[model samples]
Target: MEAIVPGPDGEGLVETRLRGWVDPASALAAFRFARHAPSAELAPYLDHHWVVTYADLAEPYEQRIVSHPTVNITITDDFRRVAGVIKGGFSYTMRGSGRVLGTRFRPGGFHAFFRAPVHRLTGRFVEIEEMYGGAGAALVAGVLDEGDMGAAIGVVEAFLLSLEPEPDPLAEETAALVSLAEEDVTVTRVDQLAERAGRSVRSLQRLFRDYVGVGPKWVIRRFRLHEAAERIYQGRDLAGLAAELGYTDQAHLTNDFTAVMGMPPSAYARLGLGN
Candidate 1:
């Protein structure tokens, strides 16, 4: 996929990334997007993301994409595509509010959180919501023209504020773990993580499952793999990448690259150059 970062004079008041559909000629379409959070949350939160959307329709249909952090009072649009069986349309995403850690989706669609520990086990694909919120529409609308994504983000944040304040210690811990995982993908194993967090391995496992939606080991593995992919795309040295990422050997890294990314590291390097 090809991505372009929006310029300073762009529509959305934030840094935006657009991943063009991979199979530009096919009926099915895929798009990945991410928006930088407001300056306040940039340090630890990284950015909000929406990815892996698929759409197909034969008639008029609308779905509500619920909020992940909270759904009781948020107002966002459905992730929508209005096209035919053989006609292709892009499924896009809009994300904002780095302060919020998790959100929900309407049934029949994927639900992803910022938690890396959980992601390592489940992989990237998930089924949580069937539809998306109205905010997604605003994010993608006039995207090429560089419209206002910040306004859409504001809308989603407002909704999160309306929910009840039920404390989720487990969720909080999971979010912390995710933040750590993203910072360093090579740090695997629950016991070590638990030691760092001052918690027992069993407690960490339970908390991760409850809030992160996946196991801790899986999170480390997936994050490492994602880092490897990013390195490959950026033309990093393969040997250095493997060593820096704590791979046992270059062969181990290659096997992981092939198994998870569906191609050797060099293939991604070539593709990264837009060849």
Candidate 2:
């Protein structure tokens, strides 16, 4: 079972299924991961309702995630928070048995629910209560107590529906633009994106900061790096990947990959092979 994503404008590279998991085979082995569709009403704002469950593990499993350029609302025994676009990789450890439920918001779709500039949440994790107050706390408790996985998702969907979020065309536009940045490898530079969007580079940056929670360049590079990881894991050449991803040189690409992924492309490939 693979997660197949479409390329730019429904065309281009479609090889990436595991968007940015450092090791998909190992992560799948570590736990049970599933994605459920949100209700029609909430579809505009959410991408999916994802759940990870594991039971009776003999030892702790740690997974490194090269997170996406989107906000996430995660509820679990340890914490319930609105997570921002993590600028770099992060890790989570699981032991024994437990469940983690999350709502992955579309690139700009979170603005409807938070009703504030989304950039403030970038690289930050705020307790749901801090933003949603008592109502947020109640949401955590309600979902945790719900035994049925689908029912728990329903609990969250219903809460979002109550917010009465109206569709924002700008949000939709932002999501689409973000998609272009993601799927269109040709869009390696922020200026190129601004040109495509018919906005000045400054205007494009402002739009991204307000809606996408990061500058356009950051988003562009992140997606490229995601592509790089997927390709390298498939045993692609490093020099070719660097050139294709718009790095000044292979070393530049290696530096960037090592910085975010904690290893060079070659080492990452070897680890994937080991798994």
Candidate 3:
């Protein structure tokens, strides 16, 4: 088994939503990250596959992530588990050298693979075997033993295909709704999103709870915060951003940004200046 030795992770290989990194510049220096799409058969349920490899650091580097709303299944030496949408921020520390192969399921897409409501996994990490029994354990072992990154991902994809993804119209609708919340900056409130989707606010809430693992409001604000991070890093005006992103005021935006990035916009902007 040969480990993957790769060059710097280029911007095109990563997603823009990865702005959740507390210090995007530093995070890039510390690790190599790339995302790949799943097979055609698994496309409906998967966002894409991701590979992270890091090595030869003089000291351990901790990376803070302002988690996305989707679920991820990560296989690495540190742990092999299923992680649901974290309602807040989280961190991972890389030491010596290591690699991680991950599967990022689309918003609402995991429901096709999970038996219960998607919310059950929110803010939680479950051992893969706990969810899929022996087959799940096998995936962990196969990925761990395989040195080649591509073959490792192939093992996981084979396991996912064996699960037999069954498409649900509601799940597809939920994915579309999440995309709208993420892509449309004008959408500031859940009610606005509900109206756009032609559903009452209450019904919309039900759909998100059942499929997205969080409310539409959280999704909309989080995506907006992602945009805010990028703009602020570029030295944009916070007051103007708050208005454009639907925050009641700059303070509200600050609270959300602080909670996720572990710092307010002003401080984050200063760090951005160094980059």
Q: Tens digit of lDDT per residue, candidate 1, span 1-275? A: 23443322244433332222222212122222334443333212223423222233333322112112111112223422311111111232433311112222211111122223333323232222312345434423423132344544444444333332233455555566666765665576667678878888788777665545455665566566666766666667676777777677889989876665556777767866663
| Candidate 2, run of 10 with poorest lDDT | 7-16
Candidate numbers sorted by lDDT from highest down = 3, 2, 1
Candidate 2 structure quality by residue, lDDT tens digits, 208-247: 8998899999999999999998878877666677878888
Clashing residue pairs in all predictions, respectively, total 30, 0, 0
Estimate every model's Cα lDDT from 0 to 1.
Answer: 0.42, 0.85, 0.86
lDDT of 2: 0.85
Superposed by TM-score, candidate 2 places the C-alpha of residue 273 at a distance from the truth, in angstroms, of 1.6
Which scores better on lDDT, 1 or 3? 3
- C-alpha RMSD for every candidate: 10.5, 5.1, 3.9
User: Candidate 3, overall lDDT?
Assistant: 0.86
- Candidate 3 lDDT over 1-275, as tens digits, reads 01232423443433434556777776777888777778899999999988878889899999988888899999899999999999888998999999988899999999988967999998999999898999999999999999877788899989988988898999999999999998899999999999999999999999999898999989998899889988877777666788899988889889988888898988989988887
The RMSD (Cα, Å) of candidate 3 is: 3.9
Candidate 3, residue 239: the lDDT equals 62
